[model samples]
Target: MSARSLASPQSAGEQKKKLADSLIKKFNKKFNGPLNNPHLSSIIVAEVGKLLQKAKISPGDLEQVEAKISREAVSESSAVLRNEDVRLRKIKAEMSSKGGLPAALLSKEDRKILPKELKKTIASPKKKPAARVSVNMLENTVRARNAQLDKQKAKHTSVFSSLGMVGPATPDSDAGNILVGAKSLPLDQAVDPWSVLIMHDVKKYEDERKQREEQKRLQREQWKRELDDQVKINERKKKEAAMEEVKYAEEEQDQLRVADIQEKKKKEAKMMINTKLKEERAKTVAELQEQKRRQLEEQKEEEKSEVRRMEAEIARAERRQQRKREEEAERAKRLQEENKEQRKMREEERKKKHRMDLEYAASQARMLDDLERRRLEALGKIKEKMKTIEVMGDTLGHSILEKEEEDERRAEMWRQAYEKKQLKVCFFRVCWCRGACNVCVEAVRDRGGEMEKVN
Candidate 1:
């Protein structure tokens, strides 16, 4: 039966009452009929009531059971729908591989209609491709649907214009009038039913598409701004790094230059010190050599003076010995002359004695007296000689004193002469000397007590 016919109020109520009355009449007739068994009928009626009561109880229990079963069935059906959704997606993949229609348009049971629709769409020349009803198509459909909306908007604008307001009517402006008109007219009054449905879906689809497009544009702008900021940051870092490198290089170069200058200065200072030291050492060596030469000359002069003094002493001793020998020879000659005189006198006396005794005796007496006088004279002479010797000794002492004084005067003269000779020699040596010899000469002249001459 048609669902509408079964649900009609008058038919549903009348059918329920007639079924109830028929069941009651069947019970009464069965008891009052030819069977006419009262006890049996009563038992049957009681059994029927009991059966009704049982039936009612059974119905109530069945209703409770059915509700529980229905809840379980509904949960199982939902599970089945979820499983079917998965199966449908898999089938969609297979069908898409075979270039069939999209599976999104069909429910689990309705998917069977998809093949028939695809067949019809492909076989009938009048049938459009499903792609014609896609987002792009829906956009176009929305644009066409807006034509009728535009007419309604124009009508609303006219109503507003009658009130003397400016421009067209807005959505917030009296949609009450449009709502009343929309309610009074059937849904398909102004447009084909299918077209009205399509237009409505198209409008909703276009609005969602616009909102998604705007979101994407905003995201693209945000990404672009981030990229620009990163580029600027990288550029700044590169510049800073390059500057730091340059600064470090400059510092290194400066340090190298300073080191080079210091090295050069050190070398110069060392060279100057060495040169000064060498010059001072040479001067000291020259002075030492000059001093040694002067000392050697003094030593030679001292040796010569010692030799001269020794020779003078030896000559003075030899002269003293020769003077003593001459004195002794003179004394021996005087004694020999005296001895010859005395012997001649004695021989003459003997000859006189023999010639005349008496006469001779008187003569002899006179001669004896003369002889005695001569002897006395000789003794006085001897005494006078002794006195002369004493006088000579005194004279010799005076001579020795005179000689010593002369020697002292001579020695002083020699010393003065020797010093003069030394001065002359030193002058000559100085005039002839070369190089540093002038300094040696100056020193010698100072030592010789001739500094005034040098000045």
Candidate 2:
């Protein structure tokens, strides 16, 4: 039982190792090998150079170090090229021996040999220092001046403490005189002009250092971003490969299913063909028998139909004769009815004509009566006007010639009015009469002209 337990663990480890090896092989094949970013190596070399410069290494030492590094790199590259196959075998053997240890559990040298992107994930990233607060150059100058002043004051105090006499009442040197004057002024104005240059140089150096630090920070961030991008690209490629594999598997399954369905369809088609052939044959025999039977039945039916056709023809002839007789009798009756309707219509037309003639006569009589009455009334009105004119002439003592002229004028007006009235009556009559002759229109026009002349 102890042996079995030990063997089981070994077997499980072997299985895991096999699984890991297969997975690694698949990953290598899918990725077409590990990443080889030339830029990353160049950046690392540049960073090393920057650190060496920061260390203030001598030019001779730098040259020697560079030469050694170059020789090593060339030798290492050649060795790697020469031992690639051996290296692969060794790696396989190691993996087999290790029994499924992960890449992270490998040694530091092994981790260094891994891809840069993978190394980033296997190792913890260094935490960047917080950025330093920037001080204004004027503020720094003021602070430096204050510190120098404080140190000078402390020295003076110490010197005075050691002396038996009190401090000097006034300064004698030019610097002492300037300091005495500066002491009376503000701190900003009291700044030593000589120190400005030193402060400026120090500020310049600080700015350069900050700038270099910022540049290094930016480069690091950019490198990290590029690494992240590479990782993402690898992940996307892996996903795409997995999807393609699934698609290929599904396509293979579909091809197999299609083949199976085609085979089944071919088998079913053969069965259906055989069944159709038998059915067709049986149907042909049955159809031949039915055809003979239908032919005999058709012959008997044709004979009966012939007899029935003769009887139907005789009956149709008799029906046609009877229909013709009935049609003739009905047509005669209809003609007699139409003649009666025509006679009644003629009588109605004649009566309508008589009524119309009477209505026309009555209208004509009414028109004539209205014309006569208007004429009589006009004449009476003219006579009354004439009599009034005659009376006026007599009352005003008019002469016979004036009265005669007045009488002539009155007669002319009466004649014009009468002619205008006659013309209007003629125009109305012409309008009332349908299709009035042109002669009547011309006469009325002539009367209108004459009346207009008189007016």
Off by over 4 Å in 2: 1-201, 204-214, 217-232, 235-259, 262-455
Query: Which candidate achieves the best lDDT against the true structure?
Result: 2
lDDT tens per residue, model 2, 424-455? 33332222121133333454566664211110
Ten-residue stretch with the least lDDT total in model 2: 426-435
Candidate 2 yields a Cα-based lDDT of 0.46
Note the clash tally of each candidate. 0, 0
Decoy 2 TM-score against native: 0.21
